[model samples]
Target chain A: MEAFITYTLFAMLVATALAAVQLNRLFAVVMLSGVFSLLSAVLFVVLDAPDVAFTEAAVGAGISTVLMLGTLALTSRTEKSSSRSSAIPLLVVIVTGIVLVYGTLDMPNFGSANTPANTHIAAQFIEKTPHQIDVPNIVTAILASYRGYDTLGEVVVVFTAGIGVLLLIGRLGRRGERQKQIGRGE
Target chain B: MRHHLILRVVTKLLAAPIMLFALYVQFHGDFSPGGGFQAGVIFAVAFILFGIVFGLDKVQQVFPTWIVHRLMALGALIYGGTGVVTMLLGKAYLDYSALAHHPEHGQHYGIFAVELGVGVTVSAVMISVYYAFAGRPPRISDEEW
Candidate 1:
C-alpha cells in the first residue's frame, strides 16, 4: 500500500513538473512548483523521512512559493517568448537528465540494510546515542550533539545569506525613506 | 486586500494558531519529526500570511525590519555562544557534556539552546528575505494580482 501511494505521488510530481515547464503564465508555474514540492514532501513521508518531509513542506511549499509570488509581483507575469532556437539547450537538458538517471542506477535499494549509508558511521551513532546524548530522537542527537559544529556552520551560512540579501535589496535606513518618498511621488 | 473581508478575518484567526504550532515544533523537536528549520519557516509563514492579507505596512508595524535584522544576527550569536561557553568550561567547543554534571542533561541544554538559535535565525532571515522582496514597489499592482 505504501509503495502504491509512493508511485501515485511520483506520478503526480512528474505531471506537475511537466505542467510547470510548459506553462507560460508565471503565476500558474509558481503554483505548480508549489504542488511539486508538496508532492515531494509526501514522497519523503512514504520513505519514512518525516524530518526532511517537514522541512520540504515548510520551506519548499510555504516559504518558496510566497517568495516566488513576491518575485512575480516585481517582474513580468508571463514568460517572454524567445525567438532564439531552443534545440541546443533542449539537447543539453536531455543529456544531463540521461546522465543523472544513469548515475542513480548504481544506487542501493531504498531501505537496504547492507547499503554503505547504513553500514558506515550510522551504526556507531545508533549504538552509542543512548549512552551519550540519551535523546529519544537519533536525528536530533546526530544533528545537535554529534555534529554540533556543522549545524552551527549551517546557521552561520543562513545568517550570511540573509545579510547578503539585505545588502542587495533590503530597504533599510535611508533607502527605506527614499523608497517611501518614491511611493508618495507615484 | 483591505476589502477582502473573509481573507482578513481568516488570517487574523489563523495567525496565532500557526505561531503556536511553530513553537510546538521548535520545543518538541527532540522527541518529534520537526526541528528548528521547519519551525522557523512555519513561524515566518504566519507573518507572511498576515502581510499578504492585511498589507505589508501593517505587518511591518507589528514586526519592524530592524527587529528582524537584529534577530538574524542574534540567532547566529546564540549558536556560537553555546560553543564558546562549552570551550570556557574546559571542554572542546560545542561539547555539551561540559554544560551539566550529567552528560544527558548537558546534551539536552546544549541542544535546546542551539535549536532555539536555529529557529530564531531561520524565521528572522525568512521574514527579512520576504520583506526585501515584497517591500519593493511592486511592478504589478494589487488589482492585477
Candidate 2:
C-alpha cells in the first residue's frame, strides 16, 4: 500500500513537472511549481522526514510561491519562446539523469540499518543527545546544540543575504537621493 | 482593491490567527516539527496577506520598513551576542555550557535564545523581501490579470 501511494505521488509529481515545463503562461507555471513543491512535501512526510516536510511545505511551497508571484508581477506574464532549439539542453539533462541514476545504484537500500549514515556518527548522536542536551526533539538538539557552530554560520549567511538584498533593492524608505544614486533603473 | 470587500473581511479575520500560529511554531519548535525558519515565514506571510488585501501602505504603518531593516540586523546581533556571552564567561564561542550553573540549563537557555534570534531575523528578512517586491510599481496593471 505504501509503495502504491509513493508511486502514485511520484507519477503526479512527474506530470506536474512536465506541465510546468510545457506551459508558456508564467502564472500557471508558477502555480504548478508550487503544486510540485507540495507534492514533494507529501512524499517527504511519507518517508518519515517530518522536519524536512515541514520546511519544504512552508518555505518551498509558501514563501517561494509568493516571491515568484511578486517577481511575475514585475515582469512579463508569458515566457518568450526561445529562437534556439532545446535539443542540446535536453541531451545534457538526459546524460545527467542517467549518470545520477547509475550513481544511486550503489547507495544502501532505504531504511537499511547497516547503512553508513545510520551506523557511523548517527549512533553516537542518538545515544548522547539524551544525556548531553536533554532535548525532546533530536533534530533540534542536533541543529541547535550539537552542531551549534554550523547553525550560527547558516544564520550569518541568511543575515548577509538579507543585507545584500536590502542594499540592492530595499529602497531605504526615505533616502530618495540615495535611491536615485544607486541607479533606479527599474 | 477598495471594492474587495470579502477579501478585506476575510483577511481581517485571518490575520490574528496566522500570527498566533507563527508564535506557536516559534516557541514550540524544540518539541515540534517547526522552528525559527518556518515560524518566520509563517509570520511574514500573515503581514504579506494583509499587504495584499489592505494595501501596502497600511501594512507599512503597522510594520515600518526602517524597523524591518533594523530587525534584520538585531536578530543576528542577538544570536552572536549569546555566543559572546558564553565567551565572556571564559568558555569557547557558542559554548552554551557556560551560560548556566547546570550544563543542561545552559544548553536550554542558549538554544531558546538562539532560535529566537533566528526567528526574528528570518521574519524580518522575509517581510523586507516582500516589501521590496511589492513596493515596486507593477509594470502590468491589476485589470490585465
Per-model DockQ: 0.86, 0.79
Per-residue alpha-carbon lDDT of candidate 2 for residues B11-125, written as tens digits (9 for 90 to 100): 9999999999999988888888888878888999999999988889999999999899899889889888999999999899988989999999998899999888998999999
Q: Which pairs clash (backbone N, Cα, C closer than 3 Å) in model 2?
A: none
| Candidate 2 Cα misplacement greater than 4 A, ranges | A173-186
List ranges where model 1 is wrong by over 4 Å.
Answer: A173-186
TM-score, each model? 0.95, 0.95
| Per-residue lDDT of candidate 2, residues A3-121 (tens digit) | 99999999999999999999999999999999999999999999998888988998889989998988999999999999999999999999999999999999999999999999999
Q: Residue B9 deviation, candidate 2, in Å?
A: 1.8
Give lDDT tens digits, candidate 1, residues B1-145. Answer: 8898999899999999999999999999999988888899999999999998988899999999899999999999999999999999999999989999997899999999999999999999999999999889988987886
**Compared with the true structure, what per-residue lDDT tens digits does model 1 show for residues A1-186?**
888898899899999999998999999999999999999998998888999999999999999999999999999899999999999999999999999999999999888999988999999999999989988889989988899989999999999999998888885568678989999999
Q: Given candidate 1, what's the lDDT at residue B61?
A: 99
Ten-residue stretch with the least lDDT total in model 2 chain A: A166-175
Error of 2 at A158 (Å): 1.4
Evaluated on CA atoms against the true complex, candidate 2 attains a DockQ of 0.79
Show pairs that collide, candidate 1. none
